[model samples]
Target chain A: MTALSSPATPWKPSVLRLGLHRAALEIKLFNRDVLSLVLVLFFPILMLSLFGTVFGDEPVFGADPSGQGGITPAHYYLPGMLALSTILSGFQNLSSYVATERFNGTVKRLAGTPLPAASYFLGKTGQTLYLIVAQTALLLLAARFLFNVPMPDEPGQWALVAGLMVLSTAAWATVAIAFTALPKSAQSASTLAVLPVLLLSFTSGVYFPFSQLPDWLQSVTNFFPLRWTAGAFRSVFLPPQFAAAEPGGSYGVGTAFVVLAVWVVAGAVLARLAFKWPPQK
Target chain B: MRTPAPGSAADAITVRDLRKTYRLPKGGTLAAVDGLDLAIGAGETYALLGPNGAGKSTTIEILEGHRRADSGDIRVLGTPPWKAAPAFRARIGIVLQEATDSGELRVSEALGSLARCFPAPRPVAEVIAAVGLDGKESVRISTLSGGQRRRLDVALGIIGNPEVLFLDEPTTGFDPAARRQFWELIRSLGEGGTTIVLTTHYLDEAEQLADRIGVINQGRLIAEGTPADIGGPELRIPRVRWRDAAGHHEETTASPAALIRDISDGGRREPLDLAVVRPSLEDIYLQLIDSNRQEPALTGARP
Candidate 1:
């Protein structure tokens, strides 16, 4: 047999370099998916505009008894929309991407390569982080211009929103990985992911006021991360008067931070235990 | 059967006493790979042939480092694959039974991305041309035909310039033309001294591509040899068929020439419809598998 003339070998790539390459490829492929891109970038803003245009500025019975200073529904719903955008990108988008790759055998093919386990995960997480950041900026910009929603007036409030965005993205992204680990196929994972996202968003105040729900229901919502995330956003986006309508007549800043932190830890652990490369048999 | 020693550094691949069992979802366990041994020399194209439920895939998976074996000794290119490192993986390429579908990625993009996973990779353009996908390089994977996708899978497998390439039923969905084209590509790769390990149920594919063939059945290594001597030379009898005034007659003989001479001596100058029937690789393969089924594995022994 003749000798195979090998090309000059490059230096062994580090795990970080491998991960960055994978992330770049992931983002390129994701950009080509028009439906998912539209959902991630514009769906929340569109919903915000629709609701703002339709719902009147009239004060509700308990939210504001004095009708003179009542806020419009646009301002009231902006915080919830922001939370929804985070969930859309972090949980729904990430999980579906993973599940589809698994079902199509992309994950198995990659597993057979020299790529490390850490690189595969870090690459996916990096893709989600980039998307969430872009999503946050786009949502906030649309809110400010399209609906006249104000930016955070205080640096402390800005700090609060940024902190919450990071925590929520990391937590939900981890939760999504765990979700992919449970489904037997990509179709099931995509269909099943919607259930928890919808359930969490509805009960956690992304679609309605958490305080207005039955007391028992509010108590149930308290255990989840989305309620705390939405409440944290409302603390920064809504005016001080809106605090009266919140569960404790305040932002619950201490509880929100603690709850999100616990979820981050719990989600990371669950992902560690559940996530399988190439997926389970 | 002739069994090879485990972990022979000289050969590209060596296996011995390889065994793996899977727990049934409903009840008892099932052994997927029983005690089996095999060896393929460096720079040789060795085909592993078997039926659907045979242990061919399980054996390949164990060798590919994708699945763990309950107990076995396997050495591929001087390393035990189960505990192999990144460098070990870089030297090998695998095309699984199911072709990976990265639908949104273009053909070049898919191969280019995978190439980055290896330390020394062939240029993406060269691999694309090698697999005859130059015209479809910019097309998205989803738009490619099944045969085109399979060609791309082969492109990705070779882009790393691996020393050993494992192809599991690589041409399962290819049309006749595509299958022949694939065979040419594989033959070219073998010429370059890459050790090719191919698993397929297609006997003709084995005859055309393999220098040596191993037929695995029911988790056991039942037959192993070159394509011409697969079932052993002793059992391979050429059949003599002839038509006389009365009726047609058939007989299996060690020498067809001797039979023809004897028939001629009986006063018929030429026997009508006389022909020597030589069994093709497919016939031998079917006979070997069929015979094994008649006497199933021992009751206590696992398949």
Candidate 2:
């Protein structure tokens, strides 16, 4: 009989499926976290506008200087902004978030429960994906409409953008989980998480342009994801001629993809090894 | 709610020679839990009472699988929690001693989600009501008062209808009314034959809720017994006091009655202030904790 019973039956967890239960809870919590909600959802769009119009209508550095292909300042900053958004949401935000959870005993509570260990991570993955999707969509809309920053016209270009965003998000989020062990405590999490992102932004052509930075700086930043995250997106957003401005004379999209994929794997392995759930004695 | 507490013959939990030690900063080692042994009858309500760092929380966490004991044999429902399968976890519940809550989820949302993890969970509304959070169901956890959040913690713990529940300082932030209600809930759960393991600072709570109480101090079980008997008959000895011409006098003895008769000369020499005082559980617990304080050298329990 399909009749609704007064008291609930033994919870048929078999029907809920693994990770989904945890994902739902995680999403609900994030939905109401005003600080993180605003930062991830609107911060990118805000950044897009705040910096989008800075060098208005000018032929940005390393783009097609002749103006034959109108790669304006917005075009230059758009990819960097996307990369910055990825770093903010995936790496910095997640590192401090996990640290706070560990320090405050959220992980301890989950650890003691019957909940599958994977569900907690799956929940984190779910939260990160939600943030990444929202941030990317918001930034794209703001760039496209608010700043009139033209998006990639071709489906192939958009597909590649989607691909890079996914890889970067996965890599950064996993690495954030692994990175939680670095700080002495939660109070230092934000400081430590933001330091690298800020430094990488300035040195890795995020706040600046990849082609404009000294060759040595470009070579050094290549080891990190921000340089490639920005480069990968710039290839899609800017015209083919802008590839000339790259250090490798191309976005090195192939290497960028490989590096991010490696980071995803490495981050996962390291996180598995380094993840601290129980409150440190 | 469950099969008459699963036959009182089997212990719901047992720990033998449990030990957990941590290296202190700048050198030296601290034995958080050392050579501790414990057992709880299948349907018993047991409270582990101690001071802030007396290792009561550590012991409970080890049982809950939140921390691993360095060396020992521990069984909760016939399985070691650290190596226990999901089925084993499903049988137990834990309320960790923490201030953290599901950040912004409504009380109902968090409870509802956690309830889905168990095989036989109490209804969401029922658990909420039991914890005195009926009206606050839709309220965000981040906004709940400290007492309310603690109630939510208790709610999440029992939502699963666990056969064995571990509550670490379960009523830490509860107001007097809330604490009383929480005690009633625990009593009802105990009456249902559910085995409960609790760690708390309040001796009255232990007396009110626990069928048996253990006083842990300096990483060892210093004393264990029922509310009336813990700390041994020696510690429970009554003190007879009187004010007379000489001065105020207090004498502790096994037989306060005979002592009173001898001192008062069969009521002829008795003063208005003559009285017999029996030490309460709280008094015994404090004496045990104070006398059993661990030295920096990491010595064992005081002789």
Candidate 1's residue-wise lDDT over B1-303, tens digit each?
122333455488988889988999999988878788888888889999989978899899888888878898788887888746788889999888886578889888888899999989999999998899988989999899899888888888888899999999999978899999999999999989889999998888999999889888878888888887878875578899999897999999998898999987755688899999888888888887887888775311222
* Model 2 CA lDDT for position A23: 68
Candidate 1: docking tier: medium
Question: Quick one: best lDDT, which candidate?
Answer: 1
Q: Model 1 Cα displacement at B95 (Å)?
A: 0.6
Give residue B38's error in model 1 in angstroms: 1.3
What is the C-alpha DockQ of each candidate?
0.51, 0.45
lDDT of 2 by residue, A194-279 (tens): 88888888987777767788878778988888888888888888777777778868888898999999999999999988985544
User: How many clashes in each structure?
Assistant: 0, 0
- lDDT of candidate model 1 versus the reference: 0.82
lDDT of all predictions: 0.82, 0.80
Error of 2 at A114 (Å): 1.3
Model 2 chain B lDDT-worst window of ten: B1-10
**Cα-based lDDT at residue B213, candidate 2:** 87
Off by over 4 Å in 1: A1-12, A56-63, A278-280, B1-8, B266-268, B297-303
TM-scores across all candidates?
Answer: 0.94, 0.90
Write model 2 residue lDDT over B27-130, tens digit each, in one string.
Answer: 99999998998878888899998877889988998898777899999989988987466677788988877767575678888888888778778999998887
Return the DockQ of model 1. 0.51
